[model samples]
Target: MGFDQYHEPPEELSQKVRTFARMITSLIEEAEAIGWYEQRISVEKDPQARAIMKNAQGEEFKHFGMDLEFLLRQKQDWRAELKEILFTTGDIVKAGERGEKKVD
Candidate 1:
């Protein structure tokens, strides 16, 4: 069969797609946590912490970009969910640090 005939994936292939989506979601969560940790380190007055944070941020960014590229290639609708999770995590971290615990 050609491309069109193979377009409708079977149930097993669908499961694989879901698994890939979940994997990307996990990577996004990890990247978000690393980003937040890097931010916290950057606020430190010590030069060593600042340097560590800079390196951490770079690594996290690379991971984030890779995950995004994979998600885009998969053409899944979970992209918004991943974005929301990262944004929510960042907001929560910021709010808790301020003792406000507010989210938007």
Candidate 2:
């Protein structure tokens, strides 16, 4: 089976790298599912159907968080940088700049 997630030759990459790539792909897929659900929910007129889509979207959000946490655990520097950038209010650009400096 072809793994489209790998940019490099799979044979040359470490097992850990392969797993990371898989999780990254999973994260992307979950984000896409969330966006698709958002669009569907926005257009749907039925309240029941919209509620179901919202529930499904919540699951996707959870999956995305799990995938991200896994990837973050694998990369400490990334975790440190994100700590500075995520879950904070005011001046997102400043937070990112601070994160960049911390990582650097």
Per-model TM values vs. the true structure: 0.49, 0.96
The true-versus-predicted C-alpha distance at residue 80 of model 1, in Å, is: 15
**lDDT value for model 2:** 0.96
lDDT of 1: 0.62
List candidate 2 segments past 4 Å from native: none
Against the unseen true structure, what C-alpha lDDT does each candidate score?
0.62, 0.96
Tell me how far the alpha carbon of residue 41 in candidate 1 is from the true structure, in angstroms, after superposition.
3.3
Tens-place lDDT digits, model 1, residues 23-66: 67667676887869766885789888788877877787777777
Per-residue lDDT over 1-104 for candidate 2, one digit per residue giving the tens place of the 0 to 100 score: 98899889999999999999999999999999999999999999999999999999999999999999999999999999999989999899999999989989
Q: Residue pairs in steric clash, candidate 2?
A: none
